[model samples]
Target chain A: MDLIQKSLLQQVAGLHDVPEGAYNIRVNGQLDSRNTTANIDIVTKEDKPGIDIIIKPGTKNESVHIPVLLSKSGLQDMVYNDFYIGEDCDVTIVAGCGIHNCGVDTSKHDGIHTFYIGKNAKVKYIERHYGEGDGNGENIMNPETIVHLEEGASMEMETTQIKGIDSTVRKTGGDLKDNASLEIREKIMTHGKQYAKTDFVVDLNGKGCSANVVSRSVARDQSRQEFFSTINGNNECKGHSECDAIIMDSASVSASPKLTANNIDANLIHEAAIGKIAGEQLVKLMTLGLTEAEAEEQIINGFLK
Target chain B: MDLIQKSLLQQVAGLHDVPEGAYNIRVNGQLDSRNTTANIDIVTKEDKPGIDIIIKPGTKNESVHIPVLLSKSGLQDMVYNDFYIGEDCDVTIVAGCGIHNCGVDTSKHDGIHTFYIGKNAKVKYIERHYGEGDGNGENIMNPETIVHLEEGASMEMETTQIKGIDSTVRKTGGDLKDNASLEIREKIMTHGKQYAKTDFVVDLNGKGCSANVVSRSVARDQSRQEFFSTINGNNECKGHSECDAIIMDSASVSASPKLTANNIDANLIHEAAIGKIAGEQLVKLMTLGLTEAEAEEQIINGFLK
Candidate 1:
């Protein structure tokens, strides 16, 4: 990998060098590096432009890193990645994408990821999207995530998009079986004239199943954002979804959360809030000798922390 | 007062039998009783169908009660009441209105109140609106409040509307001078087919002026609600506004909060949120053997508490 690609990897995946354990690095829509451990296997698909990561049963304390970097402007990249976890395994997956476009044409990436977890398996997924460039072109990313959890399985996913993405549409869907759980945390910030749209749908299909999805975002300048989430409780299950946003300057935000309960014991709820930074918060910070702009920056940093 | 009139008074205000420093009771469309103290005076207006309440300067530890009751159906009553608060005084004003409609026609009340607070004075105002009847008639209320605060003055207002009102339009406006402050807390609940609308505009017109406005509401059973609040920081001042609501069972709520900062030192913010109760709250209560309905009711009660 070149210096720019390595820098992009550091920015998106926190990888300063070659990562440990199973890892796959893709740069400019081509495979740059690949490695596999004793408990994990990474294989390229024959017909598709992606890889399949398979983890052995009972694997513990293992990790996988798949980071993609696009340093070539005007490149349109698409990839399909799938993960399969064996029963009673616990693992962590880090997947991120970064784009450095310094040309006159737009750069775009579309990533489709699907996860299948066995019974009693546990997984934690972290994904970050970032863009940096001095060119007039735009950086755009669209990500789609699908998950299926068996009985006694659990998955926690965290996704963040904080800077330089000119446009994005993110979609996530999950289905949980008996005693299974799914949790998702999403954080996004849009500045300039950027636009962001997020959609999430989770279904609790069996008794004792639960799902929780929460999103926090900030929109500044003339940026616009829309968040839509729906939770369906089809049995004796619990589901909740929440969206919170901070609006600044001429920014606009709209949130719609819907909940459905199809059974007597099913319970579902949803909440959404959109607003600006509280005056009292700013005043308290300003009283501590910080300028208004400094106070605002501190508040936003803490909020997105 | 008759038994029904007394009961209405008790419901709107905390009055069993009026015994206070100064009080005025209006039943239906006429005056029921009036009393005054050495420092506080309540006089019937000669040009209108309301009263003027005047408090002497330097007065302390005084209270006033002006409660209005409407028990006659098909009656549309409109009155203009004004308050003149003297400088260096500390006072509490209890004002409320109750309507009991037991006929086939609509009962409506329009109360227009204007307050002039002098310099260095402090005031607390509480107002509650309630309606109860078994007939097919609808109950409607339109309340308008205008406030002007002099230098170094402060006012805190609490208003509530919980039950039985079929429709309402509440409007409040305030202007704050140098070193003046205003705080408002509004709570409302709408059930059945009831409709409620609230509008608030506050202007911080001088140096060191500030304003804070907050509203909490619950909409249930097809009820509709709209909340609009605007805070203008025209000088070296601070302003904030917020609207929070819960929507349930086909209920719809829309909130629009705006902030304007005209001066370099002006700080302004606004926030709004609308959603449903949390499912975990219900599950927690249900684990204690409470029914879902009971848990829901308890959550709503505590939220509006």
Candidate 2:
């Protein structure tokens, strides 16, 4: 029984420590620490024709707390090479972080994440940043992210930036590849004095590539948030981007989504806006006796849902 | 000449005091006053047909601010009936207000405003809102506006929401009319902790009516902002709405633009987004030796140009 339990634990901790014909990164973590976890990959030390990468957070040496604001060292290193998904091969990567702290004082943090997805391989990554500290003193956090996508590959990435010490984030990422597709989505909500900034850039280098970006923000109290998304269609590629931000109470949100078409043949479409819960809809619900807050809640719930 | 200037001022002021067949509104104080403005024009007083109204703050009382945020108000009361424009009749209304003492710190604001257009009339209205007094407290505001259109009437509205005492705001509006058209444009910029929200909605109710809405937002510092818009089609109406918001430093923005089709025969389109000045575009200018900020400023100047 003990051997069996140990073997299961090892498998969960090292899900990505094997090489498959089709590139795939399967990450499963043990609930040992709140801030840090182990990374296992069955990558051969020998350099070859495969993709080369140098993760910024690297393997942890003790539970490291992401700072409220990113530091110079945090984002200094660039990944060695763009990850290549061999032609006709499928690749999927799931990478995420667990952030939790318990205390009364304010907290600030910054983190830098980088990614390079190579040609012909499809990669899907999920990123989650979550903290459990109660809203207290003014806290600021800035996190930066960058991504590069190569030709004939596809990527679907989603990020969830949830409650935490008041923080701000500046994230930058984009893709480049022929016939490649990238889908990016972010869900953010904050309270206290948290302020956040995020930026995304998509570059289509190969023909037939596509990009889709979406963002949703929810804020309350004195908190502030902002989102910037730029989708560039180069070399006759197609791109579509959408962003939505919702504000609650005294909280504020600002978002901009841009689509730049460098090629006349490029098919690009973009849409973005900021708004509160609809008044007419609220009235319709209120006529049925639902309170104002309840109506607002219903709208938000619908959006998030 | 002095007498002429005073007479002109009096005439403009008088146009606001009493609603007229010509589109007109005058305010001695802030139109966003929570108490009075919240319920302004909620129910069209039958006695005052052809005159649309809105509730706003009274400069006569220093105690009231942002009166348009009423806790209990009916949907119909928040709207004004058709303010007609006689066929080929040329008319203009000058509306301006000085507002101070808002509730939210580090916010942007757009006063609640709504409009109604009737058949065969041409109407023009210009509105400006500014902060007065010491500007000590942060002022946050949300203004709601809707426009109703009838056959063959045309309307144009211009607004500018500038500098504040750390205010935040959400402004939302739209139009509905057949053969009637509406044009709206606004410019906004903010520093300090000011955060702002602005939105435009257009619903073409009658055949051949058209609508256009355009706006821009600029923000700096730890502030935040957002813009949401929808250009909806109905009953063979045609409309378009466009918006852009720019962010600098730690500032942030969120925008969502939606194009909805209510009638298969109607044509409607809209675009919205928020983004930083492009880096590569700036770098290209910098390669020619322009400073980073100067390059960016030049790009912005070109965009505005």
Candidate 3:
């Protein structure tokens, strides 16, 4: 069953026509299964199902963003197993999950998505996870993304988790070659009593390579969140990792980052910290006439920004 | 002239007790040149002369602290290079400098200190840089410390930089092997216009290794601070690095931590952030009858706590 799913996902992901420039995507209104692209293939049955496509741009001009949205019921409820972005293409993929089907209750739901970027490809991927109102059941999402950058390739990835229905676990891995660089910024904000875990790993296999990982989390009430990151520098590779967390009220947050360097000349650094907001900042905002909640929100937004 | 200074510096470093778990130190508090370490050999006479020595443990396990006063006048009102700690054992070294000698008119004065740690040894190094009154100087302190950790070694390093200085730069490096570990923590608070930079690099070459680095900085006024850290992982090494900075008003801060993993099985992570205090904290403190400065100070202290 797993083999069939993997093959199906690969087939769907191999259909993209990723161009060499910027790609812009937008998913504004509701989209039905009948509106599927001719070049994209989607399946809804068992084993590797859902929508899959290769994003190949036809233009060679400025950068663009290729947007993807789950608007309608068929697209929203389908099981998306695998997703991949091809090599040597500078592209931006924006994906957002909207809450249109409001009345639903279940215990467990799994949505797995996989991404693979080719060597020397500069890709900017932004994922926005949000749900409106309060839905029942454990809505589980497992997004596994793997990126491989050849020599001189660079990638800037951003993941924002805001207001969710159930729980989320995101895992990401990347490989960088000589002079390659990878930068990942993540911001997670929640006030619900749920669990969220985001784990990231990057390896700099070549000489003079670099990596930057930064995460900011704000939790309120009984919410719990964990962030784990690891960066490895092998044989003259230079790698760096940074992790930070903020807890509010009864929220529980944990962040752990590890860095390892094997070569005598290799340099590595890792940092992790957990704390609350400062007092002086709150006073400054209160003096400006804003209420307590308003001030906290402003500071949270500014820190993430 | 430069050659002489380099040799003198090298000689002093060599006085570190070879490769034992003992600390050998020699000091001359007076400038008369008559009171000096008997084993001390001077290799240079020019600016920053090179010195060498071999120190044997004086059969005492007492807590040792050496004060290197940079404000002292030499043949021509020059600052003296203070040397206090020696090598080959587990020791706690405390080095501090005050801002009484340098007048307020000058804007640039460089003070540099060199330190070397041997294999299979543990060292707890505490550096406190503080000033009194308002007659501050553009003091530039560059303390270069090099540590070589053989099988089963560790280090706990702490630094506090506060008041009466225009700028500070600190660079620390360590080479670890055979389950060696290094832990460093720095707390920095600044008032007035100043610039400070803290940099640390730890390279893991052994099969089982670990590293932890943490830094906290509070900047007021138009002061600026930068922190750069790198942790390298090799041969199944585990490492971690973390930095947190709090800003007020126009205070600016920049922190960048890099973690590189070269081994496929090595684990590493890093975290960093720069931001101002929050507002809700202040409102709560105001309700408790604390003034703005008092509340802010409470917040700053709370962050360090």
Candidate 4:
């Protein structure tokens, strides 16, 4: 199956056709596996570059799709995926990474994921990162995620870095424990001299723990972005962090959302907003007839959907 | 007159006694032309440093209370006031500035006000800026205001800078015509190494002009703060700018709320937030038994009231 490995598995596992029962891992220029079942197990680390997914301990309905590809062109890769997710499980994970650089140097992807989930687990993690060809190269993604939820665990992480990725430094973090709950939804879009930075953290550690982190971003033209989120409410936990951005031409955005509490029955909140783009949302989509660059590309695709 | 000019006329013109029909300008240690009711006219320019208030064209029931003070401690002051609101007028302006430094050196105030609003005028402006004595000096204030709204005029501005000011740079601006409307409510507070910077602008030129800017701030300990608000929607206008901040400890805060829409039937919106404080609002004010610094001084006096 080649054609750039079926277009990087239909741009990151929205799989054109390949599901003899889910669980897949197909990294184009190297280790590839498929139709993985029997409660999950995928090994490909003869001591170095990436992959060893465990998952099995009661193992309820499971589904996984790990897609990674960087079709030649000054390749630079470093992957190390390790996820355990054991006790009483219910899972759905579809991780992504794609770059299909056509030349001119610089193609990098450094993914280091480690999730240990455990006690009463329920995880739904979906990730998407992409970039295309006809390239003057440089498609970089450096993602490092570490989550360990434990007591009555629950995690719903949905991440998206759509459109051609030029540079990214995203680090997702977690640790929630007693009655644990963590939800993160992030969507981003960048244009031109693109560059993105996201540093996230959520540590409500124990006693009815909860955390919700939300982000929505769109920056066009001279893109440069930064979203730093920190939510920490040590014990009687409940936290929230939010960021919303839409900036056009000569773009520049920086949202620093932070919340830290030390008991008093911890409860935290953070909010960030950067503006531009709301002339009545492009005059209500040009009164339904478009134009004005098609109503700013349909309001940046409903603001990165 | 003396006793620090009767405590700078009872802490900035809430004059312990001085009435007889309205319009007042009492700038102690310098320009004091008290009890001025002839429909506005106060001039003091022996060639330099500040004061020219004019408003006379068919002036109706005018009520103006100008407050300015700084009782000793090596005082440094600058004031330039100019306002002329004529046609079909209705006015109420209580401008404020107070500082009452005690010793060690540094007491400064710089105020520059300019407003020209005519045509169907309706104005209500209330300002309160204060700083107390018992000082090791250093209580500075710099304010610059400009407003101009002519055609169906309207202006409602309420500003408050509470607590002891140590440093400030506040610049307020406005310009709106046709069915003009402008509302500004700003409240600020700062602790220790106090430093505050507020830059604001609102410009919606004509047609159904509108603008609203709301800001609330509180920065504790080693204080440092910045809030920049900009709302510009030229023409079929409607604009909103909001900033909310509270950061404690080694306090530091920055919020930039901006909205610029150049008419596609302009409608703009902006929101900003900086966080800290709020652990369920200090556990519902310590379950009503107060303490926790009296529930954070009763939530910073109801968030700067």
Candidate 5:
């Protein structure tokens, strides 16, 4: 891989060099490098432009990295990835995409990922999106994620969009069976004339199931953001969703969270808040010898951290 | 004052007995006790059912307490109080109302407070509302506050509604002149089928003027709450408004904050957020041996603190 691809990998997936264990690196719409371990298998899809990841039963302490980079301008990339986890397995999956467009044409990427987990399995998934360049073109990304958790299965997802993406539409959905659980944390930041929209829905379908979803974002300059979340409790379960955002300059933000409980014992709640930095907070930081701009930057960094 | 009135005073204004300095206590729609100091004068209004409080110029470190209580159900009371603060004075004002109705009819109180602060003066105002009873009667309160801050003047206002009020509507407005500033903090909590609404508007009409308004609230059971705030920066000034709320059970909350910056140097922002207790927060507390309910209580207490 080139230095630009290596830097993109570092920024999105925290890869310092050629990683150990199972890994796949894609650059400019083609696979650049691939590796597989004893407990993990990575196979390229024969009919489409993606890969299939299979984890053996009882697999533990293993991880797989699938990071993609687009260095060519005017490139439109679409990929489909599927993950199948065996029962009693515990593993981690890291997937992300980065775009560097320095031309007059727009560059776009759409990713669709689906996860099927067996009973009593546990998986931790992390995905990050980033774009950077000094160009007149735009960077756009649309990612859709679907999850199905079997009985006693659990999943934790952390997704982030760092910077430079001009537009994005992120959609995520999950279904939890008996004794299953799902947790998701999302973070995003938009600046300039950029726009971002996110939609999340979760269904608790069996007894003792639960789901928690939280999103934190910041919008600056003329950027705009909209967040929508829904939680449906179809059994004796628990669900919660929340969205928190900060607006600066002429930016705008809107949040709507809905909850539906079909059972008397199903507990569901949602909360959303959009606002600017607090005067007291800024004053307190300025009293510690920081300027107004510095204090604002510190506050935003801390909030998005 | 009687025992019931004294208890109500304690709950609303933290007055265990006759307060020091100037004070006026009203119970059952009549004056129960009155006192005045050399620097502060309290006189009953001849044209209305309220009092006029006048503070002398340079009246340093002086304070006044005006508390009202209603013990009889089926009563509707309205009062208008005006305050005149002389130039260069620094004072504190404590005002609150409490209702303890144990009958079959609703008890209500409507208070209108207007303040005319002189040039270069400073003031700190605190107000609290509370209601309690075991009967079928409802407690209702509607309080309105208007302030005119002169050049170089400043004021900080803190208002709170503790509990048991079945319905309430609170409105506050402020106007700031050159080099003047205003700050307001409000807190409210509603349970059962209670309803609460709050509206705030502040105009920064002069150079170097600023205003900040913030509200925190919690809704439980089937309660509902609505918060609306508008900040108009008409000159080279700064303004901000925010609302934060918690929703539980079948409760609902909505917040809308608007900002208008007419001048190029006018800086304005607003923020709002509503949700229930976080799952991770509860789990962290449960790890310390507390139950889920106890953890939620502790979190709510800390958030409101």
Candidate 6:
């Protein structure tokens, strides 16, 4: 195995070897797609350097893991990945990006993803963006994702970006049909003048559609961040957005959460908060003989987890 | 009675007669220091137009109500009031300011208050700042308050400013000694391009001191607001700060709550949030036959109260 694959697996999949040919892996604009299980297949896009995943109707019990890696500095990777899950299918996908910058120039990745869920389908997706380098190059990621859920469909996403990234802009939105539900849980951490801005908009377009967006972030040193989330209700739906951040030193954070209800039965609520780590939490650990820095590290790990 | 006196009585005291000489009242810039007890006396400052009240030792069962008023438009008033609370004393002070502007020019008021509480003194202070006018003049107020609590002393302050003020900047700070505690509850509401900024800094300088500062605000129709609070813990102390705001109709708000601890036993926490009104809250009220405006008004009243 090459250094690229080794680092990618460790950072993203947390595995030693590939999923025994049951998954797809993309490395430096190269794609390796395998395992045609009669109902699920990965096809390369004709127009772009990306992949198109299709799940046939009634397909079930399929798990796919795709980890993308950007290993060289001055390299920029862009992928447009789309997923089409048919009716009554249940699947899980583990997707992530790992970047290793080793030069003076910046290493950036832009992952644009779209998901289409058929009626009564259930999808669980997890994505982690990790950056690790000792060079002066900046590790940047800008992810744009959109989800379309049919009636009775449900989608749950867990997205995390913890440490090592210098800059990021994440945009995620979803449109839910009747009886459909969507939930996103995001965690972010930045330090040493790093900047991150995350924007989210969820539209409850049909009756009984529900959406919830929850985020936790930590900004240290001179890092800066902005979080904006808006939930628009068009029917008898329920929506809620929440953001919590910890700021230290000269760090700054701005959290703008808004909820708009157009129908009389629509219900939406939003909340955001920006502050420092609790002193009591640190003291509790200190009483157990941990240093302040150790206590902060433990707290951040717990918060992000 | 003169028109100024009538307006002052109605605006500040909420009375037709002037307390029938039973209480101390300050109308506009005049000081009425009457009904002096052997333990409590209100005296005019030698260098300033304001007054100072000195409470001798063993003073108990004394209450003071002094509501300042700014009735004339284009008129600015500045007052410096000081209170010396003696040991073993229990007192309640109701101090507030009301402005009725009705002119083309701006009317302003600045109040600087200081309190010195001795050991075992329990003080309950309530202050409300209100502005009401139908004119083009801007009603502005800047208040600076400092509290010094000795050992075994406790203080509770309830401050509110709900309507008609165009602009304000409020700054409050307190220093607590051993076994001293301070709590502040602030409520503010603004509309129609009004602006307000509140800053608080509490220092828990002695052992066993605790402090809590909580604020709630409503900003509507392009109004702007900012709330900044920081509690510094230096000993075996406890501190907490919280801020909640409701933003509507293009209004904007920024809340920054912070805590700093220098001792191993210090414990501090802060939380803040900003968003629009929840749709379910409105629906619950509207189901009782109230219109949207009526429902919103009811919610705001309940929240601010």
Clashing pairs in 6: none
Name the runs in model 2 displaced over 4 angstroms.
A1-89, A104-109, A137-141, A279-299, B1-89, B92-240, B243-305
iRMSD (Å), candidate 5? 7.0
What is the descending TM-score order? 6, 1, 5, 3, 2, 4
Q: Residue-wise lDDT of candidate 1 within A1-305, one digit each (tens)?
A: 88998899998899899899999999999999999999999999999899999999999989999999999999999999999999999999999999999998899999999999999999999999999998588999999999999999999999999999999999999999999999999999999999999989888897899998988988888888877776766777877777777777777666656555445456555555556788999999999999999999999999888
Q: Model 3: what is its DockQ? A: 0.04
Span of 10 residues, lowest total lDDT, candidate 3 chain A: A6-15
Categorize the docking of model 5.
incorrect
lDDT of 4 by residue, A1-305 (tens): 66876776787767875655645555544766666678888877778888778888878777878888778777888888888889879988888888888899888888989899999789899899988877598899988898999998898998999778889999999988898898999999988988999989878889988888898988888878887777666677777777777777766666655555544455565555556677888998898898889899888888778
Best candidate according to TM-score: 6
- For all predictions, the C-alpha RMSD in Å is 8.3, 17.5, 18.1, 16.9, 9.2, 7.5
Flag regions of model 1 displaced more than 4 Å: A15-68, A74-91, A104-121, A135-153, A162-305, B16-66, B74-91, B104-121, B135-151, B162-180, B184-305
lDDT of 2 by residue, A204-223 (tens): 77788888887777766677
Q: Model 4 off-target regions past 4 Å? A: A1-5, A8-10, A13-36, A40-63, A66-92, A95-124, A129-158, A164-187, A190-216, A221-246, A250-305, B1-36, B40-92, B95-124, B127-214, B217-305
Ranking 2 against 5 by lDDT, winner: 5
Whose DockQ is higher: candidate 4's or candidate 6's?
Answer: 6
lDDT of 5 by residue, A149-187 (tens): 999999999999979899999999999999999999999
Clashing pairs in 1: none
B68-160 per-residue lDDT for model 2 (tens digits): 111111111222233323344445545533333333222233444444444565667655555533454444444455556556767787766
Better candidate by lDDT, 2 or 4: 4
Output the worst ten-in-a-row residue range by lDDT, candidate 1 chain B: B256-265
**lDDT winner, 4 or 6:** 6
Off by over 4 Å in 3: A1-305, B1-47, B50-60, B70-88, B101-104, B107-114, B133-137
**TM-score for each of the candidates:** 0.60, 0.44, 0.48, 0.40, 0.56, 0.62
1 or 2, greater by DockQ:
2
Off by over 4 Å in 5: A1-86, A103-119, A142-160, A168-305, B1-87, B110-120, B142-163, B168-305
